[model samples]
Target: MAAASLNVENVTGLLQDCLSKLGFEVYPLKVGWYNSVLSPSLRLPFPDDSLAVVVLSTPAMFEQAFLPFMEQRGCQGLSDPIDQCVKHCATSAVSQCFPGQNVDVRYDYELLPSRKPKFLAQTAAHVSGAAFYYQQSDVTDQPWAEKKMFGVCVHPRFGGWFAIRALLVFEDVVVGSEVVQPVPPDCVPTREGRIQLLESFNFHWQDWSYRNIICPVQTYSQKQRDYFSARPAERFALLRTWGFLPKEDHQPDISSDAQSEMITHG
Candidate 1:
């Protein structure tokens, strides 16, 4: 069930304090902020005042969270190891920080029955002021005419070096008008820059040049890049090279859905 009415500051501050030390960032927004920018069918089914927090993984997440998680727990099932680690960390944080509360946790990797993402990752990031989501619509006199170019969020500090990990909707916690929405930084302000950024992400994403559109404060390490560079299906072998092993009984497999998600945005 939902918990008693809670303060947004208390909840947001609590999550930040708990997560920041582990290389994650949290930004709080009302559910309405996200819904306003999406189509009706894509809207989250919640009250306008419902408190939600978007979680992002900075470059440090690999060393601060994933490495330690692998060392302690190992991959337990037929799922993406990175997904598993992020889930474990997010779940543990919610449980410890707000026991018995009804927070609807949605991971970026999770799909609904319709196969759509449970929550739009970039939309949540944008609405929460965590990152500026640059889209084809944002660029006037578009270059990719008649083609649907997917949007990507760029962190003000991390640029494209970060990932939107999850959304935590505090079901019972509501906020008033005092909780004004913040605008995400316009990191790529020029039309020319936006066009270049979109083209790199859409056509040459494999080269990862889009991630360097702005000078990032920190970026993924070579070790992290090596890991993400491999195909998702081949990750089991890569993990083995890192001294991690999968259970013998289970096939060293990841779902195609998971694989597509990683390849498209990874």
Candidate 2:
């Protein structure tokens, strides 16, 4: 699988299949080419004119396949369990498909603490080619930066339930399209009140709620709401029993500085 010989359609299909095998619902949000030099804020590992693909994916928990797969794997635990699982599955799939190709596999969460790259910022830059802004208002006027919320981007269908799973950077491929289009208005905020929207929009599990601006029950299925509504202990147990948790010892301890850094830029 040489990078130059990589077919976009083929590779995209392979990725979708791989994600499906790992119990993820693949939703390819954007496909484009990026020149890293055009965006100084994004610290991407790849060079200019790299082909980039951003996916908005969620753990297909409601699907019949996920629970069985988890049961088969046996369970362990991690801090960001789902993200870690997706990272592992994505890395394996990419490696198997493009053994020695010049590709970079990035995740929403930093798997390797020693190499903490800002994947979210890089994804935003690749898709939008502008300095990534967390505030929707700042980039709301910018067409390229559509679908972006505060720090994280939201999917019209998945709302906050999904994760920005992977960003595949193919050095050899260059897509012709450079124009960025606005995402569907499904998740866009209304003029009722911006502050109120942010206050209720909870991405963390600490105080999870589906009533936020981004979360419309129609977009996120009733099944997803039930999954989130589960007690934390029960959820953790289920994830652990199904081998979704990261190894206890493998979890990284974030220093105060690192924590602040993630908060500042995430």
Candidate 3:
């Protein structure tokens, strides 16, 4: 299993197997190769032609392995439950799949202090040779925002129920262009049209309100819709009861004024 000999299919299969074992459905969002000699503007930790970046995402699927651990720690050790789970699962997967290989795994929030806010977009573009865009950030010119829903990134299939999990950097790996392509422009709706649609639906943006109306993609699953439709408080309570959060402070927005603000705004 030499690094250069490993193709896209091989790596993809390996990742799928490893992550599925941890109760996650792996989605290969983007794949790109880094050539330092060709693109000097792209700064990477590895040398030219030695690194390949794979942007992987996952839905909100809770792993049973985390239950016992969460029961004891109560999500106190990590800032985000999803991040913790993704990082742990990815690290384990890489170790098992590529024994003795050099791989660097990084999450969305694990950027260095010196890194810029749009580091994810920059890195993805540099590696894949395609433009990338994300909502709530001034990173790239690509318009991928669902303006009706507070400007969150929306995928054609998963909609808002999925999250960008991590960037898996493989040293000395080669990925083909066939497996890597720019995200479809049609996936993002126009800002003006989305705003008009929101207005028509009588949706209002509220500060810290439990319910906010946003149009989902046509391909969004019914299960995903149901999950996002629940009130924030109810969702938080359920997570706490499932040992995903501390029992005493089940709510994420801890400020005492939060309830009052929600009431006033709602």
For each candidate in turn, the TM-score is: 0.94, 0.61, 0.57
lDDT digits (tens) for residues 1-266 of candidate 1 = 23664678889888888888888999999999999989988899999899999999999999998889888999887688899998999999999889989899999888899888899989999989989999888999887769998778889998888898899999899878987899999999999999989888888877788899999999999988888877777777778778887435344565544434654335
For each candidate, what is the lDDT? Answer: 0.86, 0.48, 0.47
The best candidate in terms of lDDT: 1
lDDT (Cα, tens digit) per residue for candidate 2, span 102-168: 7666666554554655465334532442212234453334433335454434444444554455666
Clashes of each: 0, 6, 0
* Segments in model 1 whose C-alpha atoms lie over 4 Å from true places: 1-5, 246-251, 255-260, 263-265
Q: Sort the predicted structures by TM-score, highest score first.
A: 1, 2, 3
Tens digit per residue, CA lDDT, model 3, 1-266: 78867875687688877765554444333333433323444455564444444444433344343444455445554244445556666787888889888877766656566564223533453335322233333323424455523333333444333444566767658545456444433343565544433332224323212122233333224443433344444545666665566667736653333332222111
- Model 1 worst lDDT run, 10 consecutive residues: 256-265
Roughly what TM-score does model 1 have, to 2 decimal places?
A: 0.94
lDDT of 2 at 262: 30
RMSD, candidate 1, Å: 2.2
Cα lDDT of candidate 1 equals: 0.86
Candidate 2, residue 187: how far the Cα is off, in Å: 3.0
